[model samples]
Target chain A: MTNPTAAMLVIGDEILSGRTRDANMHFLAGELVRHGIDLNEVRIVSDDRDAIVTAVRALSEAFDHVFTSGGIGPTHDDITADSIAAAFGAPIDVRDDARALLEAHYARTGMELNAARLRMARIPDGAALIDNPVSTAPGFTLGNVHVMAGVPAVFQAMLASVLPTLTGGSPLLSQSLRVFRAEGDMAAQLAALADRYADLSIGCYPFHKDGVFGANVVVRGADGGRIDAAMSDLARDLGL
Target chain B: MTNPTAAMLVIGDEILSGRTRDANMHFLAGELVRHGIDLNEVRIVSDDRDAIVTAVRALSEAFDHVFTSGGIGPTHDDITADSIAAAFGAPIDVRDDARALLEAHYARTGMELNAARLRMARIPDGAALIDNPVSTAPGFTLGNVHVMAGVPAVFQAMLASVLPTLTGGSPLLSQSLRVFRAEGDMAAQLAALADRYADLSIGCYPFHKDGVFGANVVVRGADGGRIDAAMSDLARDLGL
Candidate 1:
């Protein structure tokens, strides 16, 4: 009756240092909800090993599935694979299948398979490789954690492979209507509407743009009919 | 000396449901770094009381300071003030000072402070009120967590008031340059650069855009002189 829950662990210093915004979290959140997996929480940590290990253990235990992005590349800061191995107490080595993929990729590109490049082939023991069609470096699923690259294109491709394997429930549907009224003005009636549609999650997000103050009322649920009913009622009552 | 470490707990179902992207984390991360605080972790959870309380307790214990956003509004979904109170086991009621602020603002604006608006005056015991210059509803500081508004304008305004009060260390400095090179080709030199400048955090972030595969190599440290020296050495060595 309930969807499986998931948490995302984004490992990177660039994000925490304010060099980049975490686009992966947003992308994964939208895709997970569409796949019928309820995203319960998301944690962004630096590239420190202890931080990674601790967060992995905590979120993995709390949710049915865990998706991690970042720190899985070839740079010196890339330590997600080793950290995931440490988190699960799994022995990690350069797996033959992963190495084969990397080796074939380098050969095709006329690049050397040096020791630094070989780091991409490291996978924790007993983990399954999540295919990366965008890049040859494979993301792996160890225990309940799916570790993928930080790069947006590669991460999206890896998720396309991993999401189908997981069990999901009915996809959540949402409908929204924007009204030119202050949130304070709409709070009471909105609360009443929320009470009437007990099955739906009614959320009012206020916005102030171009000297106009208004709110966007959104209703979400597993049933599309309930979402439509609530949204229509909201529109009729709010006169928008 | 280690700078004060901080974490952010974003409370909203909108972010987790993919309905909204958390712009506040990015904004806060940049501001905190400028203020010399190391933002080590960020967690985004839905607008659930138990989830908020548990995250508040965990992050509050782990970091020196915690900044929370969202769920502090007039609507029924705005449960942050009560949740923070529950997290600290503090009794919550309509604090007189908060009520006065709302009362005065409503009177001046010719709007009545109705029951829903009065909900904004509820504050936990012993929590200091955080001034909301844009809106009269004040955010509060209970324990180490600074509970603030979710709206970006109001959140930024509240932070301007809150930041000057906290003690800050030397600001973190960073410098970066873009080079049209694949991550695989640059991994070795980047690792060598990172090792040479152990005092700084040297990170190479890869990107694929407009049919160009390149990376931005960034160097960060508290010491401006050290960062400059490291960046110069990187430029000379990598021939960027």
Candidate 2:
């Protein structure tokens, strides 16, 4: 059977404005792959309400799971929670469970849970809260969408909390052979090899460094034996 | 007047599979912002023909310009050129100018221009060539979409060739104040400040590093005076 598929939505004006380089997509991609889930697509959008709502709905419908990062903080720009609620047509308010977590944490730290801070307690009607070990505010899941924090450390922590609950399939296996020749020289042979191994995804990534031109021929598949056989043939063809 | 808007399409299975982190997006984002072109969206899709075609068509129609990176190499998986042609309903073939350039480069380098190498000469109908300073293979601009090589150096070179030909708007100006206070402590004040400056985009990016909690408050707009004024007020409000 095919592995479960996922799509990611990154929401932040800092990323779109060229002020921040997004680390969450890469982190999530690696984690999902390791867990035997296929991350099919990723979209990075600005902190606009309409854009976030549209992307969340489309991706949630298309893939098995939709993961989103950013716009969950307490500042004015943190509108992801509300936009996600609007997308599902779910009524959102400050839920008691979420408020209690924030309230307890703030009380221990001698801080007041003011209006702006309480905004983090808002959640959709039928959503489950994802634990945030790095901070007090919790991310929530509504339908198939998993909302997480934008900060790298907090995003990673949230993923750790949420990944164990999902079901996965066989992990994808990959092997590579580095060919110290120009991609143009090996293109025809590689194409014939790929045609022969139709089930395996054979890719040639070209690289040029230190006056050397070469390509990395990677073979990826679920069957380890098939991948081994393909790699052996590829090595023989390239005379590696 | 509003700045010209643009979108980016990153085409590669390596990216979606989590084997490679995309640096081109960050580089292009900075370049587009510097040129006064607003980057509205970015999509990363695998090296599938249908996916590439659909994304290119959608992004081309939705934005003023679409910039695409990856899947333009000489291997079998490099089908971006063909897919782009199909997206625009334009026929593609090896043009004489492109072929001549490749032939001369190979001859000078003591290499043969074989079938695989000649594949790089294929250009869609009515498309202009974007010069590649790092390699002999040329990128092309078809209508509103500009297709470039996936390699970071080559992509940057192609962008340099294309950016000068597009129109730009007023550059966005930004100023920032670093507040050494927890986000929860400053959320209320920051929200009030953001509301006060309606025209400027005020965002607070939180950070927790080395046992300290703080945030960076940024004010962005086209007017330098307004940005300076906002920054001064933010600094005083936060007592930074």
Instruction: For each candidate in the order shown, give its overall lDDT on alpha carbons.
Output: 0.92, 0.91
Query: What is the C-alpha DockQ of each candidate?
Result: 0.80, 0.82
lDDT of 2 by residue, B41-149 (tens): 9999988999889889988998999999998888899999999999999999998888988998999999889998888999999999999989879999999999999
* Candidate 1 backbone collisions, by pair: none
Top candidate, metric lDDT: 1
Indicate the docking level reached by candidate 1.
medium
Candidate 2 residue lDDT tens string, A1-240: 999999999998898888889999999988988889999899999889999998999899989999999999989999999999999999999999999999999989888898888999999999999999888799999999999999999999999999999998878889888889999988888898999999989988888888899988888888999999989888888777
Q: TM-scores for all candidates?
A: 0.98, 0.98
Indicate the worst ten consecutive residues by lDDT in candidate 1 chain B.
B231-240
| Global local distance difference test of model 2 | 0.91
Residue A16 lDDT in candidate 1 = 93
